[model samples]
Target chain A: MNFLSFGHYHHDMCLVLHRSLQLDNNSMLSFTLAMRDGQAFDTVLSRAKSMGLAVREGRLLASAKPVARAFSIQDPDRHWIEIILEN
Target chain B: MSNSAFIPPNVLPPLLQKFAPLLKRKWFRELVLLWPTLTRRRFSNKTEDYGVFKPSLVGHFGQLAVYVQDIARSRIWYQKVAGLTHSRTSDPEPHPSKPGWTLRACYMSAKEHDECLVLLEERDPSGKMSVPSGMSFFHFALEVEGNRKEDVFAFAAQQKRDGFHLNYGPVQHNSEPPDGDGETGGNVACYLYDPDWHNVEFCGAMDTIENYRARYGDKKGSDRN
Candidate 1:
């Protein structure tokens, strides 16, 4: 599983921190996310909630620190949205 | 460090030098002409560097996101399997259809820093946002900074503790082993499986955090920034 093998993002960058995990021995790939703003986090979740989506774990914005914030959620299609608020 | 001199090929060893027209073969002459032409063609095109093709939309990426399912299960799994320590969570609130329906979510991150793991609630019924598409791009990396190699290894070890084994490089990570370069610090990273089977990789550049702090401390730092 090559890290750069990942398709790059144009308008937005994935800012790959490092290689996380390889799935299906190479079929699917998974990694974490660090969103830019808390508002971005809010906007994503709010839209999903508006679409009548099911909150996977009912856990969003689970933790907060002086410099950063961390939480986990799923997208409408079941993709995990790992939100991060770095100071 | 003296002027070294080397004799020329030991008097040109008696090898096949083909000094007559009989040595000229039709196929060999044709090959000689074709080689340089092909070599010229190989370097003539100006193809775009596909490697730099951005994955997200212009200004729309790092902004757009859709919700999915399996909240509670994903949360616990992320914490235990992804080395995430709880930071905070939102209080339960009413969901639209299931009035009086409570919506709860928590925030978690790695021990080395903050905002490493961000778990949100899917809240969608049809599950249209995050389906795993063969054409779809994978998730984001945490872009860790400082002591990156150490941090990545630690994260990997933690994943082992959580019982999530990878297929390559100890964590199924697909990249070179940590080199302790100051640029990325230590290519630290690990992976985990969310409840819905979405793969999540946590990683960071060695000195990214410190570089950021030094360059723009207190400035707004996001994917866009």
Candidate 2:
């Protein structure tokens, strides 16, 4: 069993990765990362593209009120990562 | 599984002790059934107050644990792409449920948040166990900041350049609970899929549950009906 950890310097956050033999590609869990603003959101989108990753961008409405702009990307395990900027 | 019935004599109240022996007799049991009638009489008296208990909860989002195929690839994708920081990894140990197997896992978190994401893996030397079919939960969400609309468009444009498409949203919705007791506020959100086909959502401007009562008064959805 091998593992690695990644730390975000600007924030007191970290993610740990573990290696296992069991492979279940189906997961019911999803998580979100809030960006500071549109700029921060764009930075992540650009970073994904620079890494040759695919990204999806769209708008979101709440009760018919346009309140956010967001994008989606997939991690290596096929989990959806949604990045949102509020209007 | 057994036809015989047994009652511990000590469990009967002192007043009912005299009747305990008679209970074993089928004919006496049929004629002496008073408990059901008493129970129905008590229940029919609606004037009596019967307090129900509910749990007190803070309603804070906590940690999520997930199983992944490849820990290293998923770790780099989350750290580099998702921008999550690495926390710690646990030493390999025997699987909690699977015998003769080993288990390992790692934890990750975002800035300023104690809530974490745990990735777990399991291995067996015989390779007899099959991968899990899916997780039980429907989905979990993370909130992000959104200020300007143009940034979202820019993000979409970037994705288009990278040959990707937004799976859903850029829509507004009523931030109302399904029970219809809370005040309906507005929220904007979108969706995407992760490596394991998990549905991830990005949302902004969510409503708080506190003001729903004041705004809607005592008229709950059930009351309206």
- Strongest candidate by DockQ: 1
User: Which ten-residue region of model 2 chain A has the weakest summed lDDT?
Assistant: A1-10
**What TM-score goes with each of the models?**
0.36, 0.43
| Interface quality of candidate 1 as DockQ | 0.08
- The interface RMSD values of the models, given in order, are 14.2, 19.0
- Using Cα atoms, each model's DockQ against the true complex is 0.08, 0.06
**Ten residues in sequence with the least summed lDDT for candidate 2 chain B:** B43-52
Residue B58, candidate 1: alpha-carbon lDDT: 16
Poorly placed runs, candidate 1 (over 4 Å): A1-12, A15-87, B1-68, B91-104, B109-118, B124-137, B143-146, B167-188, B204-225
Question: Model 2: per-residue lDDT, tens digit, B128-192?
Answer: 42243444333344554352334344444554465543444443333233212111223344444
Stretches > 4 Å off in candidate 2: A1-87, B1-55, B124-132, B146-165, B175-185, B211-225
Candidate 1 retains true contacts at a fraction of 0.01
